[model samples]
Target: MMFLRYLAAVPLIVLSCAGVPFGYLTLSSYLFQRSLPGEPAEFDFVAGFVGNVTALAGFWPVPVAFLLFAGLWWRTAAWPRISLLPSVPTAFVGLVTGTGWAIALGVALPLVSWGLARLAARIVSRPISGDVRRSAVEVLIGLRGGGRLRVQSRRLLLDRLPPPRYRESPVGRVAIPFDRIGHVEAGVVDAPAQWRFGNTSELTITPGPALRVIGSGQEWLVPVDDVDAALRLVVERAQARAKPEPRPPLESARWASAKKLWDLGEAQLSQTGQRKVRHGGHHVLLVLSVLTVAMTGYSVFRVFTDGWGFLFGALFFGAISYGTGRAWVSAGATQKLAEENPCSPLADDPDPRHRPITGWSYQPVVLGQTSDL
Candidate 1:
């Protein structure tokens, strides 16, 4: 199993590092020339542009793809019958440049996967969104009660969690239909007291109101943002859906759904911050780009001078410096951000309910070194 994991990871690592523009460039060039026989000049220009872009975008998907693949594998590696097939498509998508067919395949495959999963769920259990089979419901977060609670519409989907808990489940969902909904309430809860030095300390919870759905002997407390517009839309949509006669959708209701309103509120809150700090990591990228260009120039020089030894030395040394610089810059930026906003999701916290209550999960700390076994 360990051998298989290492084997699976090796190819993805190699592809992310070297396959990006080069392999795709070659494949795309051949494809374009064959497909567009009449447009030879256009094809040449397109192929050359893609190749150059990929070359410039060094280590194409490595930084992002490496972490994603490793994280997924770590979780399921212990399972005897683990399947890494679901991650294959995404891994492939990350190998290519973020353009042309790559973009289409990357984006389309994930959407199709999600759609198919939803379709299967509907087939197995009763469809949550009655007549509107494909209901426009967005899940803000998972509810402890069972499945996730839909943001606006009076709908709830069953849990997709693995067996045991699923087997013991009696009911798939509990939803208060539009007309059945008695009243909706939104309010804020103060952070629970924290113990420090054997004494309680009062700490203000992160910004945002919580939602409470009350009707049909069920009251579910959802710990997501409770924007006024979202709460108002819930009432309005319920009224609309409950109406006896059919009518065209209202203008506000058509474009701005409950999810949109929640997103707008989130944006507003983020922008509400008065303190401004210089953003991080762009300068690191600028340095990387400059070094890459310098390396490219040297490669050209070495080709003319036939300086193989110097070329190899520069390549190895430059890679080490680049890796060191990347690691430093990433750490520095994260530290700066955490220092600036201690309560931000990126910071460390001693609070146990940090994630469940506030949706602020603690970021994992990466030590500078680990002792050898």
Candidate 2:
């Protein structure tokens, strides 16, 4: 039945056939019309070869066909893993697919990498049982950079930063080990200044820094609801794994070294006049969007001298930049929705302790964890 459905869609998929000629023509015009005088023979040969290849490979229709077929497969396939199997064929599909397909694939390639990485993580991640920190569901892990604090349960799992071995896989992130965790701190702190947007009149809940873990003198921010509870869980988990065995001289020395760095960081942070400005992901996107608008203005100016090509290009590119900024802002807002008033346990200490958490008093709360990759 699925095969018959795919067969029926073959003709519509072939509508992408128009992309081949369109891509070739666009590239030929761009390459031939551009005035490149006094260039070396090697450079010309390379440039011509690249142009031909790009036109043949990058044609936008290929991705449209792929996306269409992907939707078809998604509806019929029982397992998500099966859907990813098609990625191997994508390279072959793009080769004959044309310039439009190639360009579309290039754009989607990052999302593809990210998707595969997440999928790989799901496949390899083990289930949580007892004190062994397996894949966790309730724990919302956030890295230094701002992103949605994805809920997971594993004691150690790949996050934004994948392990060295899965470097190309894009999904296997190495999480901070609970065994090394020394401190879990939370408090009502001043929210980042940029978060002050859209709340000019009403006093919004002061967004505090999320639960922080101090380990080996470094701090990791964990964005989770009931941050105090999460802190207790981490502390409890760490304590459960703690051994009374004495530390080796070398190990103690490394701890001492890490302590010095931690103290140095604290001293720098305490100094009011010499503060470094922090920029979140949203801020970066907003800045880039503004810059893109300025660049678009230049392109618009070029349109008067060049043609409709520059005009259309500038509009399309400009919209993409603006759209990215808007999208990031929306995502940030959704993440903020999870924020709650700092619970009593967390509110007790805004400043994270340098010492390792041991013998936590609070009972563990079994909050549900998300399996979203």
Compare the candidates by TM-score and give the number of the best one.
2
CA displacement after TM-score superposition, residue 10 of candidate 1 (Å): 40
Give me the runs in candidate 1 sitting further than 4 Å from their true place. Answer: 1-148, 151-167, 170-173, 192-208, 243-373
Query: Please, what are the lDDT tens digits per residue for candidate 1 over residues 23-82?
Result: 444554555465564755534656675675666565433343333334333322111111
How far is 169's C-alpha from truth in model 1 (Å)? 0.5
Candidate 1, run of 10 with poorest lDDT: 193-202
> Candidate 1 clashing pairs?
none
Alpha-carbon TM-score of each model against the true structure: 0.27, 0.29
Query: Taking the tens digit of each residue's C-alpha lDDT, what string does model 2 give over 1-373?
Result: 3234345544433322232333334443454444346662333544654565465564333443354344333222112222233333443444455365455653454345335334433333222233323323233344333433333332322133212121111112223344444455554334432211011111122245345444332334443455654454555545444333233343332233212222222223221222221223454454455556666877898999988889887997699778976876664433222111111112232235332122222222222321220
Off by over 4 Å in 2: 1-98, 102-110, 119-140, 143-177, 180-209, 212-223, 226-229, 232-373
TM-score: model 1 vs. ground truth: 0.27
Query: lDDT per prediction?
Result: 0.37, 0.38
